[model samples]
Target: MADNVIELHPTSRSDLLARLRDELPPAWRGPRIGPDIPGWTDPPGGHIHDLVLTGLPEPLLTELAWMAHWQQVIDGSPASVQPLNQFAIAYRRACDAGHELATSIQQIDWETGESLLNWYYTTRWKRFPPANTRFRLRAVFHVPRLALIAHCHQGHWWELDEWHPRCDPRIPIGPREPHGGRIIPAHITQPWLREAVKWHLGTQLEAGTLRWSTIGQARQLTRFDRWITVAFDDPCDVLSDPLAAPAQAAEFRRWAADPVNRAMRSCDRRHRAHRVHPRQVNDDLRAVAELFAFVAANTRKARAVLGASPWSAVTALHADAWRRQITPIRHQPMLNADHYVDDHALAQITAALPLLALPRGQHMLVTRGDGTTVTAEGFGDPQVMRMILLQILTGRRASEVRLCEFDCLTPVPASTDDSEGKSLTRFRYAQSKIDIAPDTILVDDEVVAIIEDQRRWVRDRFPTTTTNYLFTARKSNLTATKPYAAGSYTRLLNKFSDLLAIRDSKGRPVTLGHTHRFRHTKLTRLAELGLPIKVLQRYAGHATPSMSMHYVAQREEHAEQAFIATAKFKADGTRIRFSRDDHDAMHLFDRADRILPHGWCMLPPLQSCDKGNACLTCSLFATDATHRDVLQHQLDDTTALIDRTTTEFASRHRRPMPDDNVWLAQRRAEQQALTRLLDTLPTEPGQAIQGHGCPTAVTEPVPLLPDPTFPRRTRP
Candidate 1:
């Protein structure tokens, strides 16, 4: 192994100088010059000689000059040369003694990279932690030439511990921008297993199944990998052997379920027992299953790449057993009342929206953990308040609200005014989760105004930006290409809540960390307003009605109260008054069979309705003002049918059919029943017709047949 390891020698001064002179433009290689020099171009301005005179080692000097040149060209700013020179001096001495130093970043092997980085961090860049070292190394590796060489030679980016979005195109730039994209093979503790996992992840990336957003979830497989390393003397053997699967699977399940092996410990100060959340265990098992399944599916490819098809012998039974063992932790119910933001919290949050703004010459008082007060401009970007407002009004997902295009609003034509008096506008946003959902919805003037305000702010702030998004990221986004991060808005909202000390009705401090609650609140409010389910489905932008139904929480008591509040009437237009005892006995709201599309069944729950379409003419049938439109439509259709049938009969037999015909009689009876119901029921919903005398109990069951001569009195 020692013989195979490649040794790198530092570049000599003459060689390094020659390379730098050849690589850089002619204008850049001349005598030392400052920005004050006349006719000095920004990048090619003569500063290479000054860098050479810094007394730094040849390799470090050349790298720094190249970085300075690249920074001036890329970011229109020169690299900070003084601090890097001071650090490079120390680095040169360490290299001279053969201490913690690599000849070049490209030559640093993955196994020894961490120790070198730690040494640099602790001895030199102690002010910045390893996590934040990227900022410190910005001038060092941001150079395209160095980064490309490191990638091409070392088979990885210059940063061995993490991969940035620029490292791979598949890695998303937006989600974890500015910071590095994902932890790499160096993060794995076991060397033998690291390469295998790396290969597996690469395969998944090539297959287009793995996403950078979900990479954190995919990392859960490392726990299983670590367990395998401990369980088997030679973990590599288990990958190829068929019989090792069942035992491995069983042992992994036990290990993952154990509280001692839990990934995260309890942080509570009360010393609560650290229990492994079922979700964590399930995520681990799922990752393992996915890995094995992928290998099994692509056996030849897996063998060629990984040198072994891990879990190739895993059968359906083994998979089933693993799946069955997964702890069934039900997520918070979709219709959970607490999921929606109540009126108290919502009112407080809305009232505090103005405080989110950082007005010129004004400061917000912020109290730190130590009880000391300091003034801050405001929470975060003031645009977040408008984003929150949009969510509360539109019930859109956070992503949809945050990633809205600059031209998301289109003025609705005045001719299409269904909003009565208010102006309606069609608001458009990306429906990322559902591919088939409509991107545009009709919003009121208030929603339109909010979007318009955001548009104006964006235009004023980024006048020269070419990006089309309404909300652009404020940090590390020079070109304004990236969308406003969802996490940024969430943090801003939380800060706003804390600053204002917003509280709910119960006096507990309101934390709007989950902005989706605004969406839930909006949907729940719409549902409460008695909007038709299909219409609500469209408004929510759900692909299916069932998905929309999940947001509506109709409790049994509310349903019963609504049922009792609605005025009921029999087929002959006589009102059916229900006493308290009669309401209890009928169980009208509890029985599913009693509920109908256009009306309710007045018959007892024990009896089945034999009359199918005869509901309109049945004596026991009852309906209210809500079904008036349906009844009227039915009556008009029946009248049209009667006219068409009479004309057809006269044409076929050369004479009109007898008036006493059963079909004609039934049609006439239905028409009369519908007309009487529509006329008797008030047009306004929940309005009941006044009875002449004391209310009667609806205890007697009536026949299903129509009774034309029935008296116009309340049923008893």
Candidate 2:
């Protein structure tokens, strides 16, 4: 037994490495690894002292420039840290990543190609990691599982079109970079990916019991089958040919057309018992299948071209079939399932608030519908909080955010100042788990308020047990089922799309397909306001600009506005007075603005001036006088106010002065700048004029209404 085990595991080689390490002495270490500290190389003899404990996450990869250095192996007289057999396993895993990477990199220019190759070579190249480098990439990236498991894990998402699968390989999976030595041809991953798609489609079609012979009249499928065909093919059609290098597209097309992979058109149309279709629907499943088949086949071509992995060719072929030919067939109709919210768009909406993603175990304050706000258990809770945050930032009320759904919001952001005075603050969470599982819902300020208010009403009524989820599911005791998944504000976006009220330069209300979509709004605003990329990264809690981009798309106009409006302040509560301030994004208020409770009101601040007199120095300033006058004029003509034009119009401002002597004295200088406008304007412009009763300016509460859900402690 000992001999056999030794022969299998190579204990002698392990022993030899151990003996060599002991012989080398402590000072002669090659690399060090442990829980607290990452791996590092020893300057002495290049002996790698890797700390491989029972369990730990894979190390992070180094920058692209250092890929080669990451994969270097320590050269010993006759000893090495990883034995030959173990090395083979490691290489095998890396080969999978390489397979996927080959497809991703196939379109890169020579320079980018070289850089990526460097990234791989340094960390996993096996040449010899640099003297002090521990380049570890994601574990999943290293060992791509492009099959049923891959589809099950990540391959089968309905939004593959927008996700840009070919482009998305850049999105890193878990960490655990391969030793750069794994070199599989890229062609392998292509086919495997297709096969994985095939598995997903197969499973879903099997489970749904849908008929296939009923192809669309557009094709040959029946009405129901047509619906399924559209549902499945929509994504494929969108992804079939994206904006990429022509060569890549050509190569992709050729690979898809390869003889080894054949398109499946005629359907059996029979399930366990359900007879979906009596005869074959569309005898010809044209470009739809062609697209999938091509993508699947082409993906394989990249793998083969690049020598992606050691997976059998049959497996690769199967993968390609799955991605293109098979996966599209299943596409379980998202029956009774609410649509997936555009999370990135949600982040875009919350420009003023933080829209971030923290690692597992990170904590945040979350408020539930029952008004019970707590530092919830895990990311699940924070995700809930994110929904709330989205509502708050997008200017939705709690009730609105809670019930927000398709066609709820006005075309424009609701401000208290509008004549309706009451901006529509309403939204709803879409159904949860109707099809594939939906991400948790979120609550924004308005939604939080509604929940808090509802909680108070509930507490007054129930007075005993808690009712946390606003949209709670009710099931009979006899039908035991999965715990109810709560809906959140994050998904409320689609509900409020009508309320977005944004218009393009073309004067048309922009149509955002996804309902949960304020994230893009906020991000677009911030990006236009020229928030530093790094700051955007921090604000959005993105691991990198690349990752953040996956959520917030950049538009040229927004970029221009961001450049023109960016503002930075010093720690001393003073503006960083660079000449760039002219183009800097002007934060309307010196401090973050709070939504005042009594009245809806807020406008751009007075233009940058030396005591409000830089009017002459300013170039962008409209012919309007002191910005105060401009605002007052706009307010006076409030009924005719077309839109918020260049906020940089000339204006002098008075500070919002405090009531006390100390406060008055300190804020005296800027009092006219901030206070004059507030004192000058009435809460309701209509009432202010025509000798009607003057309405006090109603604004958001300061420090915000205490999250009614968060239990407040009494003073001792």
Candidate 3:
């Protein structure tokens, strides 16, 4: 009975190394597990370590412990950290339950294994184990009814659960999810080629050269693999026959263009289903070509004949043919103003946010069309609502808002001009997709308060744990504490919309898609208000102004309106005459007469003049009382020349700027001359025009508008 009740204990480093070395194959076994095998080295000699190795089989447990490192050297890799941790949890539980190590390894079920993995993740570690480092397991869970599992390992926790059967050899189930979710090679008819491709992809995944996110590459390569299997009766003949490469590439082109093959079809996320798109066709062709290139370069037989890979040439030829044959697919632009939420719909969504965010027990009423109201409890947890609010206020992507940490919100220091002691609060968070560093946005006090409340909530809920995330879910019976899944807000937003009976201006039910529209709505509104392109670029986290423009609608109209408003043009259908006193008008110059009807010069005080008398095109040219008479006479002469040139060109039917017509060039030049003269000339007799409209010979330059759209910086 005492022997059956195995008191688990940590093994010494020397003893553990001896056991692991013994488990290694005959070729690998030595005085020490050293460099010949990839990861094994001198085990860190420590008396106080985390993992307790008692009641485990000598070979299997030893192998599992060194699995992460040895994966690189082995042909058939052992479990990665995620699945290894999961298997360890299950194996430990059986051993603790008085089952022998051998029986425990075989008895663990998927359901039980998965449950323990979630518990380890949410309750003990709160995140997955770190990669590329050796793991030292900590305390095992041995509480009654709850199975024993390894909780902490390495510096982080061993908690990320995976369904990879190959990770645990003791499991009887066949491997369903392959390494990195790659399509199984068994599906391909060519046995040897199938194995080769599988090994290549698996090695890439283990080496960290390829990621699970990029598993789509494996799917793409599989298309080519299937093609190879059919094209050559013997697929191995690809290495022997050099001609197979070009023949296969040509066949692929035909296959791609054939509508019958359905190679051109792909899933369109916009429609939420599969649809035909040419870009996807192009991607598929490129994927196959790249796979061929990779195989040719790496494979010994193919490389011996082909000096270098010929797939580049093959891909180029196919690309040209594809361009000629396929009608160009008109892609939906990344930024479409049509997708922008209407103001009325946005307003309703904004108004309902506060009510929806109200914590449980707080009552709110939704007014219906017939004037009857529905009493409703809070829409969701306060943190969920706070996340939505963050998206709206900061115009951040929904994912960015959801993944924010506890200290993401910080108060901006008071500005130099902020004598009233009021300062905007800054929201800072990570953008995982783009690898963008902490993006910071300054928001008003209302947003600041919401952030504070959310931070307090997360802190209160996770008082003891190091989970500083602003939003978190405790582990339930089956699920892990998911970092808010992408698009988590979409369903809740729709629910809130339904609850409020919200409708757009057209009387259509308003529907939100993935909360991205909030970003578009905010940016579109800013664009509509005529924010500068540079400012929009910064706000959108875009690399270029062109990328930012996708969010803006009616830019030309907005620009024209902004021009009229900011220039403060006179009403009554007449251009306002400038006086020397009106220096504010002179500062609006965006490089001279290309913009303003009356040209302006916004150059610094000490700048030297380059253009002597060419005031029309020169940005620095300013109108004055002294130049009025001279400008007026020039305008009269230029108008006469332009009229004569137009009459001559129309009567003769010559080109507008024919070789024989010096008058046309003269007329264009004089046309600018006339504008220059008119701008300097006063509309009213009493007013004197300086550059553009400098009244009273320019006294002092008015301060330019300090754009509020810019993220205002303040001292820390």
Candidate 4:
């Protein structure tokens, strides 16, 4: 008998047995042991108890009793006797082999528990330990006393294997399930580094500097820890005196830049180079710099635990210099032409949306590219289809669409000045990325209807749920408290694309993996409609106009090319031909203010227009074939107004009004100008009314006023 082992007295054993008999059900009370003992079972139920504690070792019996008591209390039901049977078999094997036995659950560390599981599986079951072994150990470690002993409180931080962010009031709820809220600390191999990283992360959380869903930051630090281990003989020594390890730091730069050193994924084998993306390297370096800066700021307190500060002697200048030493990687620009979904693909996807409405756990029959039929799981939830439709209609980010609150739509108040009399709705969404962006945007009736339909579905599906989200996750979420995960939605969308065989204009398979493409496509369409950049910025919910400009800039370039390619007509129906120099000097596409509803104002960049809405009649205005419909509409509207005014005046005065009536004359002049513009435009579609045969040519170039100093060129 070891000193750590507790010897239960006969009276104590009798009390335990009596309590077990009282608490356990009849099926778990019958005696059955030896070769008849079964392996691990789910819902662990049967007719007989495989093992009894009547004649077991006192230490093993005491451990089993403690587990049984806690299990019953936690479950609020009669506890299973499976753990006793499993451990008893291991104990008997240890006795047969003359191996040391654990006195209690507290004495069983991870290695000792693993060996016990291995013996139980290999000898009795004749197989290797299954995945459930860790789960069983997790159950054992969750015992009240064991958990208290393992976890430590370190001033606003808990040092534990896992952290549940949802349980903490300081962390905001993210668009993920409660289980996804866990932040595991086991990935950081170095204990000291792990502690420091935990402290840094805790400080960020406390100060509200970290986004609740940002797990990549922690993963980036893990890469740094791995590099430190590989790059130095004693990582702790190097961390303690970072400035002194110049050579090691240089080596790290080389190691991080090498593609061979990068982690390999299953798909990477298809590529010949297997090169790590520069963006990943940049993220790793940036994370390391941030961690070092944080450690340097709190030298005294951090040093107490880490033995010495990681980068106390390093200054901001030193960190900046180190960052500059790495090769700069330019950000890959996202071009709208390359990323936006074309009309062909968008139409196909919209038509196939109904196919995604399969019920949960049911598979749909799909034809593969090889013509073989196979059953595959669809999105299952109709809300996912509605969510996709909302993304296309509203052009919102996937997070904003997926994490919408149950009551996100509200009717816009009718305004006295609204002449259109169209019903409007305002949609509110979470602006997760930009803090300064407004959450509400004006949406159309169609968008409102989609949202309302989703709301109805949520109500019918989860009648008892109290969650605020419109879209709820189905897995491991009995209460429907978790919003749909972004990753899961993306995976399902990819599957949908494959099942429907969605193809692009080029006949290649179109992947809807990047949901942001919908946003880009919407912004690009708005830009093509000649919406101002400032308005596009607000519509996009961007913090700055620059991001909106990125999408508009590409569309503007195409517009400019179209403008230059077609023939341009002045107010007097004179066709103007642009020499290369004339086109550069006019900067026709550069100024947003000069972009007219029906044409371009060919005014120089330096000039300003004082007459508003008079571009249609200005000599500087240039109209092409594309504006033929708009020019004809303006002419028709002007003629109708003039005739109506004349008739009303004649009726009031009992005679017809004269032609020179001041307002009437101006209206006549505008009407005449629009008629002439419409006549100059090509009647045939895709026809260029250039220098060939239609109107008198002003072939030389339009002259501009000279200036002593050059004016600033406006961006397109």
Q: lDDT of each prediction vs. the true structure?
A: 0.60, 0.32, 0.50, 0.62
Q: List the residue pairs that clash in candidate 4.
A: none
lDDT of 3 by residue, 592-658 (tens): 4332333344454456567544555442444434455666776777788677867777688854536
lDDT of 4 by residue, 1-716 (tens): 37775553334534644654555444334343322323213232232444455545654565455445434433222333555566666767777788877555556666776778788788778997777755665455444324222321223444554565433333444443232445656688888778878877767866768765665667777766778787678776655444654555566667776765554355654653666677777776666667767776777767654575444555554455446555677765645466677666787778667667877677767654334566766566787898889888888988888887888887778873246776788899867777778888888778988888888887877675566788877553445656777778988888776676766555666677788888888888787665787888999998788788665435433443345444443344444444433443245655666666666665567877775665654545555566678878888888999889899999999999998789887787777667655565544333323221112222112212232243334435
Cα distance off (Å), candidate 4, residue 565: 12
Candidate 4 — which residues are off by over 4 angstroms? 1-118, 121-155, 166-182, 240-247, 264-274, 308-318, 326-336, 360-379, 416-422, 507-509, 553-716
Model 2 TM-score (2 dp): 0.26
lDDT of 3: 0.50
Which residue ranges in model 1 land beyond 4 Å of their true spot? 1-103, 108-135, 138-161, 170-185, 229-247, 258-260, 264-277, 308-321, 327-334, 359-377, 499-503, 506-509, 554-567, 571-716
Q: Write the per-residue lDDT of candidate 1 for residues 548-648, one digit (tens) a residue.
A: 87776644323333444544455656744544224423447477676666666666667777888677756455565666677778888999999999999
- Candidates in order, TM-scores: namely 0.63, 0.26, 0.49, 0.62
Candidate 1 scores a C-alpha RMSD against the true structure in Å of 17.4
Residue 420 of model 4: what lDDT?
77
Best by lDDT: 4
How would you encode candidate 2's per-residue C-alpha lDDT over 52-141 as one tens digit per residue? 211111111111101112222211111223321122233335555653323221122334333444455556665643422222222212
